[model samples]
Target: MNHETKRDVFEGLVEELANAYIALDGEGIGEELTNEEKQAYMKDYDAALPDDLPVIPELIGKYLIMRKHDRGDLVQALDEGTSFLLDGTQWESVQDWFWFSDVKDSVDTFARAWVLGVWRVEETGEIVKLEEEK
Candidate 1:
């Protein structure tokens, strides 16, 4: 796939993941939330996600590999420059590297930090802690 196509796919995946997270967060409190309250919550959640996230090539490659594994579509992933399909060793390697690596840890950390109003600097990718409102 081209760079633009990859970016679109990555963005769609991010949106899907964010919506799922929002839905999961609201699960038990759904009944208590008014329409305006839910809208505000969604707005906040959207704002928490960085709009200027650079499309990290490694992350996008891993995402495509995961999608190929899940959907059994080797051709598409290979077309996008993934080497092997999810065979035994390749599957284990992909799982270990993608799911258990520092990349995942960083993502988890970012999400946790975002909940506390910390954000990443788009240009430098530095983590900044936001001051709490009185």
Candidate 2:
């Protein structure tokens, strides 16, 4: 999908998740959900997604990773191309991936690959660059 279309679909999925979360239990007078119960609700929401929308794996993975690491800012930064995740080898391969390949005038390494920046976290929890944006 194109950037705008992909973003619209993602937003729709997010809205669905949000609505499901709120509807899991009607707003209570005093009974609040425990953390575990909240997680269980999210799991159910995930399981209930229709099987036909398999492309949503990336969106779900992104959300789960960011949530696990408490990295909302990082997600925004990555979206803005201010951060990078792949190493040189992986970056080269990704240029062939549809996300880049489907873009207008996007180039592969055979000519000059347009690097899409994403942040990489090392084992030491250090954020590092995968490539310089050309």
Best-fitting candidate, scored by TM-score: 2
lDDT of 1: 0.44
What would the TM-score be for candidate 2 when compared with the true structure? 0.22
lDDT of each: 0.44, 0.35
In model 2, pairs of residues that clash are 83-118, 84-118, 84-119, 85-118
- Candidate 2 lDDT for residue 122: 20
Ten residues in sequence with the least summed lDDT for candidate 1 = 1-10
C-alpha TM-scores of all predictions: 0.21, 0.22
Of the candidates shown, which would achieve the greatest lDDT relative to the real structure? Answer: 1
- Per-residue lDDT of model 1, residues 3-119, tens digit only: 123345456657755765667654453234467866755555554544443222243344443553456344443343334443333442334433465554543443343344444
For residues 22-102, could you state the per-residue lDDT of candidate 2 as single tens digits? 766555433445788667655554534222221212322243243334534533423443233532222333223324543
| lDDT of model 2 at position 73 | 50
